[model samples]
Target chain A: MSVLQIFRKTIMAVVCKPIAHFWFGLNLLHKERLPENGPAIIIANHNSHLDTFLLLTLFKTNLLHRLKPVAAADYFLKGGFSSWVSLRLIGILPVTRERKRGESDPLQACYRALERGDILIIFPEGSRGAPEEMSNFKTGIARIARQFPEVPVIPIYLQNAGRALPKGKRVPVPFVFTAIIGEALTYPGDRAEFMEQIRSAMAALKEEAPQLKWPEQES
Target chain B: MSFPFSLPSNTSLTAIVLIYGLLGLASLIYLFQKQRGGGSDELAARLGSWWVIITLMIVPLMLGALPFLLIMSFISFVALKEFLSITPGRMEDRPIVVAAYLTIPLQAFFIWLHAYGIFLILVPVYAFLVLAYLMTTYGKVERFLPSIGIFHWALMTTVYNLGYVSYIMFLPGGCNGTAGNAAIVLFLLIATQLNDVAQYVWGKSFGKRKILPSVSPNKTWEGFIGGWATTALFIAIVGPMMTPMQFPESLLFAALMPLVGFIGDVTMSAIKRDLGVKDTSSLIPGHGGALDRLDSLTFTAPLFFHLLVFTSYGPFAMSCS
Candidate 1:
């Protein structure tokens, strides 16, 4: 394994997995559904900075080397320590959220990574939001899925991550979080239809465990 | 510094050997059953994991007090992390969470220093008050009662109660005769864990009538009584060898230890039931979380600690001077 891959594995093993298991009480369901081989797209509803770590924790150790997260360049690759962490430690593929005057296509980075047989994690919602509340997905994932029709797009719904670390919080509170991985989807050939399918699939997962519903939805 | 290869006395050695012999025989029977295609893969996996756990536990213990204390602290840290992870806490409670994590090391440090006075009050008295004040600084009363309660209870059960195991090493040698402090700690672990196994086995074999159907449906009266009797007998036979307690006190210790350990297990089950999760986390393959593995220890450690201390120093031992 490469040094960066080794570093990522060590961080996940020593730091992320333990913290996720111990501090956040992370439970992963239907992880067996995750394909054991080949490239795939993992799309999830982002709730906290923890969403990335929580999702990564679900995969077995050896599979981690094949996993590359697509992160927002504006936030993660602004240069300096954050850029180092994004490029070196996590090995994230930084996709520029905002297109600059003469900059290359952001999707090109993601497309090439997927073509190279890397399993990519993408939060189609674009950024973090409140728990149980989902934003409309950006079409970047749909566009990428269209380009790589052979790669499966797996949808994951993360519950309670917002309460664990939420946006704007440096430290996370311990809250039991669950990651529900839905069946992988082949791109339906229509971007809007694909996005809807992904969204509905995530919504359908919320019904899997009634107890995991948001407190407001209980009564 | 010279390390002792053997336990302080022949009694302790005999007790260890007997325990290992029983485990070896159980593994042999399990292997035989597997050959006949009558054994479960789950049981086989559990036995395999138990070998690793036993080695991890016994080796450090053999190294003496500091290693044992460090291991116990690491367990507490993991257990507390599992406890907090499963329970819901708000983002506003971040400071309190940090404080909770910070308390683990300090608590272990106090036990390491043998500052019994400070160690005793560190979590119950000081960490409680400090964390409560820290929560107030957040100025959020949305989950005031529950938030504070979760933080306090997590510390008490995970950090403070489990810390008592390490403190077992600090118990005055006079309390345990020449069997040594390691013997007492090992005795508690053996009785508590064996009680769990006996209860499960007896429950499967002849259990009828639920003890607490709502909380833990699998727990049955037959298992409870059978386990209690067996564990109590086992302790009575082996206890004197490990602890300074004579027959009557050994009998009392054995009886109470299992009962308390049962309560601890059931209490954790109730919490899991309320939270709608099976185990705390799946850190251990067949065992569930660190909390699952250490549940019985949480209750037995503190109760046994006080019982041994009081028995040794009499009623005035509360001062622990």
Candidate 2:
């Protein structure tokens, strides 16, 4: 094995192994929700740090398959071995959310990854929002759906990622959690209409678990 | 083989006795407190068990036995028992054989003897293969493979990792000075425990951002940063006092130690979730069972041991020299 692979595995063995050990509490509400094959976008609610690994472990796929997680450039890819492992070894695709005017858009990296038949995980609630309700989602996901209208967009509601690793906390309180993968929402043709459908679908997904109270319905 | 602190001295012995006595009393009181409310028996149980862990760590060291091996075997046995108790095993299964429990003590004994070669291989390779062969000899039942595999891996990870504590204790030049030995062991323990406490404190106090919402709900960015900051500070401060290493180096080691320990804690949390249980067992009041207690130690032991082993000496001569 290459040195990079060895280092990645070693770090994963030490760090991610525990995450897998602790948070396998996920109950897939709809296994059939995921497409059997082809490129897709997994749009989920951002909650805790555990979101990355837990989703990776719970998402349906052959054990042999690999999925790329699109994480924030500023946080997940923070300096040192932590970043290297997350991006390179764990296959997280980093995207910069905020940039100066006329700068490159972050979604390009994700758009390319999705085109390659790789699944991309996106948190539409720009960042982790309040526990009671999801913040207004950024239109990035809708735009991506429109861009790759052919690819399926899987709506996933992570029941407790927010509570597990709330917005500002470091330590996760051990609790039972489930990653509910709702039915896939394909890119509806109209830009405005499609955004509304996706938002309602995500909100409906959040309702399945009464534990999370979705924010007031946005018009 | 004699420990320096083991020598006779009434003052030192009395002080040791008083300390342990107070701790034991506190544990009992904590146990009683649990019974009183009629609501906190679980916490009481955990706290009571924490006494034993603390005792094993502190009392023996105070008495000068340096009973590190004893503690290792005990933790291994306890954690293994916790694993087996939760997991069902058939009486007829050879891997579930009586010989397995017996091996717990023997493997511990090998570790005590510092037999690295035999100790490491005994579980994963030899014992595992033997158990599998025995299972095969009985003919393959449909559910047999997975059942045997889980049992074997659980035992191997729990018991073998426990044995590794011995390897850690004997790391060459890792414990050169009297103070150095105490510092290293204490530093490891403190880092592990402090990581848990600090994370909880941080998460509880200032958590707002959600990092992973599904697996562990209470983890937060605020808590992570605050806990990490405090832990790093503690590491820097306590690192120098406990070891021969200078401030920044000790600080760096301390910081890494807790991060590693945090990983260990979460790993066990994940395992418990898979098993569909909480707190491993009710063996400890106010704390979880042995598995919960040993969770951090399992990862911490290997990490701390390896760090010392590699830094102090080459891989080839880690245990023996």
> How high is the lDDT of residue A22 in model 2?
38
Name the lDDT value of residue B298 in candidate 2: 78
Model 1 misplaced regions, further than 4 Å: A1-31, A53-65, A80-85, A98-106, A131-136, A146-150, A159-165, A171-182, A188-197, A200-219, B4-12, B314-321
Native contacts present in each candidate (fraction): 0.25, 0.00
What are the lDDT figures for the candidates, one per model? 0.81, 0.65
| lDDT (10s digit) by residue, model 1, range A1-219 | 778778778888899888777666755667678878659999988888888888788888778877888998788977899789878777788877888788887689888888788899999888887665788888888889999888999998887778767788776666667777899899988988988898789888865532531245354
Docking class of 2: incorrect
- Score candidate 1 by DockQ: 0.33
Docking quality band of candidate 1, CAPRI definitions = acceptable
Lowest-lDDT window of 10 residues in candidate 1 chain B?
B312-321
Candidate 2 lDDT over A55-100, as tens digits, reads 7666442421447788788987779999977777778888887867
Off by over 4 Å in 2: A1-219, B1-52, B64-66, B88-91, B94-97, B172-174, B180-183, B244-252, B314-321
The DockQ values of the predictions, listed in order, are 0.33, 0.01
Worst 10 residues of 2 chain B by lDDT: B7-16
| Count of residue pairs whose backbone atoms collide, per candidate | 2, 63
